[model samples]
Target: MAQARQLEQEQGQGSFVQSVKSELFSPEKRQGNLNIALSLSVFAGAIVFLRNFGELLAV
Candidate 1:
């Protein structure tokens, strides 16, 4: 009984890992993530530039 329970647990874990891999490594998901990252980086850069604009004007 214990061995059966352990085997079931392993199967569950395997499926969980496989789902995670699919979600993370799928091409469409990867491209979406990349786009989100690029957009966030550009927004951060714009924020930094606006915050430092006064310093630039002073120089």
Candidate 2:
């Protein structure tokens, strides 16, 4: 059972890496991925800014 679990984990990791490589090489997906990363960073930055602003007001 342990051996089977290890094999399964290795296979899962390999597939994950393969999928990432495919996405990275595909031009169509590149833009979508960049947009997603940009949006997530902006959202996080906004949250941090808001938290600091609130703290400043409290002081």
Candidate 3:
């Protein structure tokens, strides 16, 4: 009986992990992640441009 309970718990844990992995790598999540990365890159580029502009003005 104890072995059966342990096996059930192990199977449940495995399925739970698989479900989480699927959710993490789903298409919608990937798109959202890509959008976030693109936005961050754009933001960084803008900051760099502004800094360069400020240096030019200082000189």
Candidate 4:
């Protein structure tokens, strides 16, 4: 009985992982991921620029 329960749990986990993988890599999700990446890049760049500007002001 314990072995059967363990096997069932394993199969359930496998299906859950597959579902998550499918959702993550779907075309619609890819576009959203790209937008997120671009936004993060722009935000990081702005922060770096502001820090440099502040240092220059301090000097």
**Winning candidate number (TM-score):** 2
For model 1, the local distance difference test gives: 0.91
Q: After superposition, how far is residue 46 of candidate 1 from its true place, in Å?
A: 9.3
For residues 1-59, write the lDDT of model 3, one tens digit per residue. Answer: 99999999999999999989887788868888788889999999999998878677675
TM-scores of all models? 0.58, 0.62, 0.49, 0.54
Candidate 1: 10-residue stretch with minimal lDDT: 50-59
Q: Number of clashing pairs, model 3?
A: 0
The Cα error of candidate 3 at residue 37, in Å, is: 8.7
* Per-residue accuracy of model 4 over 1-59 as CA lDDT, tens digit each: 99999999999999999999887788879988789899999999989998878667675
**Model 2 residue pairs with clashes:** none
Positional deviation of residue 57's Cα in model 4 after best superposition, in angstroms: 5.5
lDDT of each: 0.91, 0.91, 0.89, 0.90
Tens digits of per-residue lDDT, candidate 2, 1-59, equal 99999999999999999998998868889898899999999999999998879677675
Better of 1 and 4 by lDDT: 1
Each candidate structure's count of clashing pairs: 0, 0, 0, 0
Query: What is residue 3's positional error in candidate 2, in angstroms?
Result: 9.2
Compared with the true structure, what per-residue lDDT tens digits does model 1 show for residues 1-59? 99999999999999999999998788879998788889999999999988989577685
